[model samples]
Target: MPRYEYRCRTCGDTFELSRPMAQSSAPAACPDGHEDTVKLLSAVAVGGTASAAPAGSGGGCCGGGCCG
Candidate 1:
């Protein structure tokens, strides 16, 4: 299973859910029972070593970024 981030457009709430990849884009109601929620196009932290960079800092070096 993969974790996904979603934002509820109706109630302006953000939440996460773990589901199969096939359900990544499925229409899902917010946990708060709001139906006008939509999946947010957000970056998921997959397998990798964690870093201490500040939030929004590019993760590559050598003129690219840190993560590169």
Candidate 2:
């Protein structure tokens, strides 16, 4: 299951729900009893251990040096 963020248009309340991907865009009701909720676009972050780059090798494009 994937967690989805929803925002209620009527009450301006936001909430999260874990459901199947097939229902990602399905209609959802807000906790405040508002049915005019819409799914909000959210970012997903993937994390990993940072490793040092080899000598003379170009680091990450951002130049943060987190080139693993």
Candidate 3:
């Protein structure tokens, strides 16, 4: 199951729910019992930063002493 973000047009409430992909865009009742709701775009968890060094950089002090 995938998570989806939803916003309620009636109560102006925002929340997330885990449901099947088929229900991703289905109309869902608000937690406050409101029947009018709209599905919002999902947000990314993180920026996906790379922590390791790039390939072919080599294990040297300054690119094989080019800067030395």
Query: Whole-model Cα lDDT per candidate?
Result: 0.81, 0.87, 0.81
List the candidates' TM-scores in order. Answer: 0.61, 0.67, 0.60
Q: For candidate 1, lDDT tens digit of each residue in 1-68?
A: 78888899988989999999988999888988988988888865877547655556555464345544
Please provide the root mean square deviation of candidate 1 (C-alpha atoms, Å).
Answer: 8.9
Using lDDT as the measure, name the better of candidate 2 and candidate 3.
2
Q: Give me the overall lDDT of model 1.
A: 0.81
**Model 2, backbone clash pairs (residues 3+ apart or across chains), number:** 0
Model 1 misplacement above 4 A? 44-68
Q: How well is each residue in 4-33 modelled by candidate 2, as lDDT tens digits?
A: 999999989899999999999889999988
Model 1 lDDT at residue 31 = 84
Q: Model 2, residue 56: what's the lDDT?
A: 54
Candidate 3 runs further than 4 Å off: 45-68
By lDDT, the best candidate is 2
